[model samples]
Target: MARWKAYFSFKLWLYSFRLKKFLGYWLAVFSVIWTFTEFSGYFFTAVDGSPWKPNVWGVIGLGIVAAIWMSRPLLRRTVLLPDQEVMLEIDINDMYARQDGAWIIPCNRCFLHSHIDEQAIVVQFRNRFFPSPADFDQVLAQVLQNVPYELDTVRGTQVKKYPIGTVVPVQLHGTRQTAYLLATSELTSQGKGDPNLNHLEDSLKSLWSYIAENGNTEPIIIPILGSGRHRLVVSRYVIIGMIVKSFLAGLAQRKFTKRLTIVMQPKAFIHNQYNLDEIESYFSCAGKFEFDSKGL
Candidate 1:
């Protein structure tokens, strides 16, 4: 029964939408199912008995769509965390302060920046290390002087070999959560590639590899990494869906936990079609499994 129900929704999505889009199609879908139900009723009437006698499939089809809509409140309002069975929750909330979970923050190969980014997660994290009223570069120098490493500060940030598709875990002091400096791009050049899907997918794969090897066994909390400072070209919905896919794929390697939590920056638009509500709707139900991408 579930398989057939999924098939109906999948076919509706497969028709015209590529990936990361299903909401608008969903409206049209209700009509399509209505028409299917009517046709089924007519066909059954001719073949067996009165059309009104039983239209079980039609009722089921409409019921499924209604159920999806009704479930939205639970999907959006609840804080669904990743656990042993692989469930994901989407929230346009803070990523830094999540409970004992590790955070996966993206960075350039050189994890340094001139000024704090107003929209990126790094800004929220800056105070944790340098505090306020402190010069970012100078504070970095003073902080780095005590550490035993052969790195230098440049471009408003410290440099490293964290090229695209690499992740460096920066363990925090007096905290259970470690900060993963997920390297998503070489150095975020102006005219060059920012976040092509190939790089993003590979980075996700690398991130999972690190998790698998380290065996940290902590619930993971990650922001939508590329959308803000990284200037990733993908739409929010598309990227979020991509993220769920990669994360789920990673879990298959080893069930990191039962739930995966993603913290989205408060958003109004992502390629104009996606939003946190849709993200909640998609992942909490059939959309996550049905979604796929040609670019990635």
Candidate 2:
């Protein structure tokens, strides 16, 4: 009897949590109500009374309640996904060492950092910690010597005077390699973007294109673009959503496999910004991905 009770309790728990089972119960209840309404309508018509009116109202009310309940689960699922699968810690002093097919390099002059992948590197510059152009150039030269491709030309620094939320993809050391620099004006002026969705879209689109072109065969390393001291006020959810949307859009256009590695500096900040639910939601929406923590 105890075993039977335990089994029944498990079944009840499953019924309550499983979406299919919950919907099934609602559907069955509605079906029975429909049948009763049909029979009562016929009987009431014969007796000169209306029984179908209450049945119709009940169905509408039940549907509204069911819809509200169903939405709760869907919303939770959407918000709980993980945006970036792999997360690594990077330090300024040990930036040259290779880990998992990539290197995390810290800039000498500014808070700006670079994640060097097999084919390319993503350099994130926070306006709050602006590095001199010469300092940036020197670091780039040093980093290029260790990379696989030859440095030809550096492109896309023309719009440096623009506001926060500007993303410029430049040709670094020629056309063989590229470095995408995401600059947010908020970090420079007040620290944060204008919460403009279009700005986020533009930034993601540029990053996505770069990833789609270069990251098909090699792993791409990225940083938490705007979550630093520059834009310290931004919500993790919004940032996560923007990253996920951009990656998905970019991935959809690609015909090959890609591995993206996102590196976070000051790891404690990222941990505080996002929780397990956001990470889970990002993965669920992203399809196939993995998560790991790397200490630099």
Candidate 3:
């Protein structure tokens, strides 16, 4: 029953004009193939010497071809940028369980590891990567030793707050892979995260710079920053656009990672109405943007 529902959902998406331009190109290709095959029977006559006419079987075969072509956009959730080795994906899965590459976990400026809730991504990172909370803090401390703090305050749980774009690469246990703890959100007086668009872009820039120096061309998995608890006053789609734009700008300067996956949980994908086809379109057109040293 669930499979049937999913099939219908895909069917709705298939012809919904979300991928209309791609669908149009594929349909044109199939039409040319059919036309060429039909005319080929005239010149390269078979033993039977019968001209092939459009029949039910041919129509069914064409339908199958069309279905396969349309399904390509919906089925394959990843896209490679034009003339670039870097691959971009919009994966609908848990970021931790999906890959072994460096994961970017958006964190508050304070770099607090003990105060996050059970549902936060930071807590999930601790549970998945570390054997215990102490181990997580140990790795975090080792990475943040060189990172400078912007201000010192006696208020809230943390006294020192790191600047925006501060990235702490946490070396996972028993593996050489690293997970970047990116400080994208500012810690407010009430202990809530205060993330803005400018800060998000800065954090991403810092993330790519750190990865370029430290990463080994491994795939990097990142969630849509500011889409979670920070709740930046922007659409999830816009946040995704920002992430891709920043990453591509970074890529222009140097090749850091071979692949970059922008992970969205299944719930977020459904609730936010994210279309991978649309994301792919956005990424393909990203070539026009110039990479400036200031920001994307």
lDDT on C-alpha atoms for all candidate structures: 0.57, 0.40, 0.74
RMSD of each: 12.3, 17.9, 5.4
Query: Which candidate, 2 or 3, has the higher lDDT?
Result: 3
- Candidate 3 accuracy as lDDT: 0.74
Lowest lDDT 10-residue stretch of candidate 1? 70-79
Per-residue lDDT tens digits of candidate 2, residues 1-296?
32233223433233234566556766766777777777777667633554544557778578546744653222112222234333222221111122333222212111233322222222333211235545665654453444343112112221113332233443433324434455332212222233344555555565555455654344444554455433335665566555655555555566322444444332333234334333554555454543111100
Winning model by TM-score: 3
Off by over 4 Å in 3: 1-76, 150-155
* Candidate 3 lDDT over residue span 1-296, tens digit each: 32233334543365334455656755676677677777876677556776755564675577557755665435236777667677887776677866557888998888775766887899998887678999887777777788777665424443678888888877766787678889998877777777688899888888898888877788899988889888798988898888888888888888988888888766665555556667777767766667575646
- Candidate 3 minimal-lDDT segment of 10 residues: 1-10
Task: Estimate TM-scores for all models.
Answer: 0.58, 0.39, 0.75
Better of 1 and 2 by lDDT: 1
lDDT (Cα, tens digit) per residue for candidate 1, span 194-251: 5566777788878877787874677777777677666677766767777777776666
